[model samples]
Every structure is written in structure tokens, then in C-alpha cells.
Target: MVPKQTAEIFQILSKGNFISSNGSQARLHDCISHDDNFRILKEYFAHIGYHLESGHNYYYFSQQDETNTNMEKKLEQFAHFIDVMDFFSCLDVKPVTGTRYRVTQIAEECFANERLRQKIFALSRKDKLIDKVIEVAGSLANGGFFEQEDEDTYKVMDAIHYLETIISLITIDDDGEQKNS
Candidate 1:
């Protein structure tokens, strides 16, 4: 029989969100990771055209065929993620799984560091430093790479590996060209 949480899994993954092992929905993650569940869910989702794909301690859905519009939108979204990851990579506290970050603290860091301030300014049009930080953090949170614990604190989720993996796969050519495989 299919897992009891099949509907719950479908609800989240179908919306393009991940069930990350370190996020609030970790129970759902555990459900998917259990023996036979992945195979079962993969078959179930496949019948409906979604391919249930697993990443490092996380699960999401992918479509076998995507329209050009969807592909373009995803490329745009990934480009935004590149900038967001760049900002996070420069932080004193890296964006590893389970790492918690506070907006005010990050804003203070940006206030003290001209480089960080410039990076965040490029990412957000918000007038306030704190708002700019919030925009970046909120983007990640909305994308399932981070989960907001409270009003000000957000914790990185295991799904962040998806971003890291994609970013790491990118390479700069000898002619200063960027390429992704």
C-alpha cells in the first residue's frame, strides 16, 4: 500500500517546495525516506506526471517535460538564487544545514562591512539595511532552502545542498566564460 502521508507529500512537493530533513516538515522527510516509501512514492507520482526526486536528505518533484516558459522562469529564479547564495557565502556564518541566522544580526554585520552592505544593496531595493536582509532571507525561506523559526530567525535546511550542488557545478572557462553542466 502507498504510505499514509502520500497526500501530504504530494501537497508539498507538487507546489515546488521541498521536505527537508532539517526543516519543520522533517517528519514528512522521515516518512519519505523510510524503506520502500521512496520507490512507492516515485511510482505513485509518476503515474500523475511528476517524478519524485531525492536530494541529500530532502525530496522534491520534477516534471519529465517542461514548457519553455517554465524553463525560462526557473532559469530566472536560479539566477536570483545565485546572487542570494553569493551574499550568504560571504557571511561570517556559512549557510550550512541547521545554521540559524537572525535578520538583525546580519543587518548589523552589513552595517559594519562595506562589502556586505554593497552586496545586499545589489540584492534588494529596500531602503533599510534590515529590510534588505529580510528580503534575501525571505527569498531563501520561500524557496525552501531556509525555514523561518520565528519572526527574525531563519534556519538553513538540508535542501540548501540543492543550491550548493548546482552552484558548485558551475565553472569559469579560461576565456572568462561561465558554463554549467
Candidate 2:
């Protein structure tokens, strides 16, 4: 019954592996974000040993478990994801969430602007501006922080909740080195 009701929506979300409010795909995007439908679907997903979590206009899963062997590995992945998230968070306009971004566009901007160039330089040892920008953006995309829109275009997506959760964890982390001299 649950699967039937949400067959189309689930097919798209589960396959593309994204149910993005910040996506350019109109039908799938609107289906998940719609209030009444979201409420019903959220309840249905909870029955499958995963709780649905909301983050800034996005949704994701929170597995319910007592003993998971991969917890530490997951934590390490999240740490890396958090660093990548911070990089995106620093961008002005939040990279215009869900919008397509081109490596050349950013590289061109960096070449024309001192601040952007500095930011690119800060990201890598790669001398070429385009390569440096793509390296940073690609890492985030690999981590599910962004989705490839096409051969050269990428779009931020709802799965960014993974990064948001990591950022929240770091925000309250007390295990930092003391700076006192």
C-alpha cells in the first residue's frame, strides 16, 4: 500500500538517490516538499526502520540501530563531509542552491577576481584555476553534497542534509586544541 501510493515518487527518489527540494526537477522536487504528501510519506518511511529527518528544506534518513559496526567509518566520512560543507557554506549566495554551476564559470570568475582566485588557491596546489575549482567541487559532489546536472553542470541537492548534520556536530564539538600561548 505504501509503495503503491508513492510508487512514482519513490522510483525517482530512490533511483536518482535524491529527493531534492533544491533540485531543478520540478515534479520530484514538488512531490517530496508538498506538505500533505510529505507528512504521509514521512510516516510511511518511519515504519521501515529509518526515521525521516528534515534539514533546512531538505530531508534524509536517520537509521535506528543499537549496534552498528561501521559507526566509526561513518564518523570519519562525516568529518570530511563537514569540511567540504564549510567550504560551500563560505560561498556567497549559498551557490544559489539547486542551480547549475559550471567549472569554467567559477574558474573564469576566479581569474577575473582577486578574492575568488585567492579562494581557489587556498583549495589546492593545482596551478590552473579551473582544475583547482573542479577538484574542490568534485569532492563535494562525490560526497553527495551536489549532484551532477550534466557533463559540466552540477546542482546542489537535498542530500546536503548529510553535511548539515556534520556541521551541527562540529559546531558543538568541544575537542579542539587550546590556542593559549
Candidate with best TM-score: 1
Q: Estimate each model's TM-score.
A: 0.94, 0.63
> Compared with the true structure, what per-residue lDDT tens digits does model 1 show for residues 137-165?
99999989999999999999999999988
Weakest 10 consecutive residues, lDDT, candidate 2?
10-19
Candidate 2 lands at a TM-score of 0.63
Taking every candidate in turn, the Cα RMSD to the unseen true structure, in Å, is 2.8, 4.9
* Best candidate (score: lDDT): 1
Cα displacement (angstroms), candidate 2, residue 24, comes to 4.0
- As a whole number from 0 to 100, the lDDT of residue 141 in candidate 1 is 91
Candidate 2: C-alpha lDDT? 0.64
